[model samples]
Target: MNVLVLMLTVLNCLSKASERTFPRIVPSQLQFLEYTNLTVTCEGFFNDMIQWRVLRKDEKRNRRTSCNKNTDAFGACHIEALYPSDSGEYWCESDDKRRSERVQVTVTVTDVILESPVRPVTVGDHVTLRCIKRKKLKPSTKFDFYKDGVHVNTSSTGEMILHNISLSDQGLYKCNVSEKGFTKENLLQVKAVLLELPDRPVLEGENVTLFCRDKMAASNYTTFFYKDDEMIGNSSSGKLTLNKVFKTDEGVYKCQTSEDRESEEQWLAVRGGNSFSTSDVSGVTHFNMFYLSGLIALPVLLFVLVFIYKKYKGPPVTNEEDEAKYTALTKRDTSLYHELKPPNSTC
Candidate 1:
């Protein structure tokens, strides 16, 4: 019996590894603007139990789910709500009685643009359009990107991203998002930038990083940035970066190489300021909030205390005034004293 159990364990391990070996099925094209229908198929020879999951690029872990068994040999499972976060790899387990293999499937929702023109955009321009996904993908299904009707790029983690593009990237742009196997599309106009920062831009108060990139690409074409027709200090590394920037750094900026080839002038504004006021109005307002109740209740409390004292201890009498009144009464009684005098003294 022990030997038989050991054999079963080995067989189970082998089957598990095999069931995990295959990739999940994905569609070549998806139809969006309709109800979601994301059907993911796995290679199977196993029992009815199928494992499924969704994941995000930023997440280090995956969420798990149990799948409903397909009644046919297709071994497919369907999920609904194909939102932006539902874009991820899906795996299914297929156990063939004695051996098993896993299938890994990639799910894609159709993200095609519904509102973009069929022309390539020029440089140094911006475009705006609305994106709509009809498929009922989960809130996690991200939009896929494309150019010229071909898969040129992707944004699986976010809904939108700026291209910071050049003339070389001129093509039609669209979006693809899917859910449950249903697809969505969003049309967009792609434009090239003739004058701008090519890489990530960092704006600083005292120190500014400046850049000027040409719309055309050539390894030998030197890229240079000029402010008021003056070149920056120097560059140990070829990147245009100014550390410890100042307000004086703000000015008209442009890029040029070979003196004749130049981009349009662009303005960069850098406002420099530092403050240490104990009396900023907004700050004071927040700081003095604690004193509001006490300040308001002070007069009312004084009035109440006076009323309470009058109720409990009667009215107050001044000792000096009372003494003066008693002295006057004694003076008036002095005549009686004189009448009763026994001829002793000058009454």
Candidate 2:
């Protein structure tokens, strides 16, 4: 009984831990032009309890605030006109102290800006940086790319593409148009290792493969795979394949290289094969609840059926003595009826 309680407690914790809360940004970019609108919304199961909080660039503390005018009915906060003063870190915070990932936003009034991904890119990813100018540029315009204030490459299309980026590629990047001017420097972060898996939920009983690759293209290095902080396996090829994955196989997974470089941990969700619509981890929890309910209800159902049968159809005569007792009772009733019968008086 104690073991069962422990199992239930652990499963409940897993179920609750799987639900994620995060802030969603419209336009999905960290940098914005002055006077442009920005929208932020908290997304999760407890969105109603979440509120927008920001650490302004000039301020040392974070404070809760609403949109410039009013928050919409859907809980989205809108900044109608962004200014350089609005540049800071923004995130969602719940009343109970739960916080989401913070996003750094920059608002600039420059004539040109560099367009890049807001999030860090994995090593070996092909990344493209575009130089956007407030005014249109000529088709034959020449753009110069710089990393950390050093000229790296030049492009004619007003964009620079870095093929198979490595750690050395991560630095402050800027672009200069031939006639326009230079844009503000933007930071490019490249991770050393990346663990690859399916972005969508995997179906139970399906085979899943996870690959861990070194951004530097190292040939011989042992890779270690972990699930929920527990080591599961290792390989020289930096790949791990799980055959016929079950709900129990679902958890947070990450990989590490021989040099101790680790990738970010990601959740692996497994859903019932028959239930494609239920995509979250709660689906597995529901299945577990149903299974447990069946286990607890089966015995009671059998007991109730036996009780109803005995209450209406009577009990079975399991022994000869019981059968004899039933026969004697019937015979005695018949004899008594005969004794109580009066002699035939009708003529």
Candidate 3:
């Protein structure tokens, strides 16, 4: 029985590692105009339970029904009338929660513009930025580039390339193109890469170590570790150790080499042993509930106060002397009219 169990474990690991991959979304542009239709087709074997998911920020939006109608033949889905809230990373997943590679979509309720990729890119990777012109792409000569409102480069092509992007290359990049004697500018952002973190969960009071790796791993460079954007530790051995982890230590952790090429930031969850529960209801955290309730109720409370004031106190008295005169005149007129009126007559 032990031999059979060992064989099964090995087989499971191999099966997981050799799992078949899926093709990306065709006509793959990340950004789109609001109310536009997006048709995406999966290019791989599809299971009956296969569905699509959207990942925005740190949260994932799961679909209730199958995105594809005829999965046994072709796997495709159409999104009609996209909104700004629809912008996120989209991917296909099986019933068992096995997910395929993600494709990002950003729907904007603005003019046609260029957009950057929604996916995180690593250092030494080629990043491509695209210019979107409504439903289709258009060609234009004399393209000007700007970084944070500072002019950088000019190209005859609409697309701009950042070959082997580094830390300094990360910023808000804008492209200006003259179309029909009118110049339109669109913005895109680039970010630095973060380092890989520990996969295993660190229990409270336990020690944790972080490592930084880059493309030039062979070269020797000092490593710096940051927690919640604050520098916490640094080491020459390319590794930093945090002794006695606590719930306070749980935050976004990242590292960077001396070359300034940073790694991807990852959340470090310190669970067990008096740690706070991370389980949330429908992806809504306690903090989010409080924040949303406060935001929604604040304006309503202010509106109620304003309505009560207007109903009871009426409008503001901009000219106090004039208001007083008006009040006095109204009272005097009412008294004189009452005095001049005839008394109640009894028949």
- Model 3 over residues 198-310: C-alpha lDDT tens digits? 54445688878777776655567788888777999888877787889887886666787777767655656565565222332223344556767898999999999988988
Q: Tell me which residue pairs clash in candidate 2.
A: none
Tens digit per residue, CA lDDT, model 1, 190-222 = 432234531211134445554544455454456
Off by over 4 Å in 1: 1-146, 149-170, 174-223, 226-246, 251-269, 272-313, 316-344
TM-score of 3: 0.41
Residues 1-347 of candidate 2: C-alpha lDDT, one tens digit per residue: 44455455444434343233335678776778788888877643232223434322233345544333443233556788888878777765545454555667778887667888766788778999987776544454678999999999988777889998888898999888767678777888778888887645667889999999877656899999998789999999999999999988876688999987887666576766763333344555566688889999999999999889889986666799888999999999999888888798442
Task: Rank by TM-score, highest first.
Answer: 2, 3, 1
To one decimal, what is the Cα RMSD in angstroms of model 1 from the true structure?
Answer: 25.3
- The C-alpha TM-scores of every prediction are 0.30, 0.54, 0.41
Q: Residue 255 of model 1: what lDDT?
A: 57
For this target, which candidate reaches the highest TM-score against the unseen true structure? 2
Best by lDDT: 2
Runs in model 2 deviating more than 4 A are 1-25, 40-77, 92-100, 136-142, 177-181, 201-211, 215-220, 225-253, 268-347
Cα error, candidate 1, residue 172 (Å): 2.4
- Candidate 3, clashing residue pairs? 193-262, 193-263, 194-263, 194-264, 195-263, 195-264
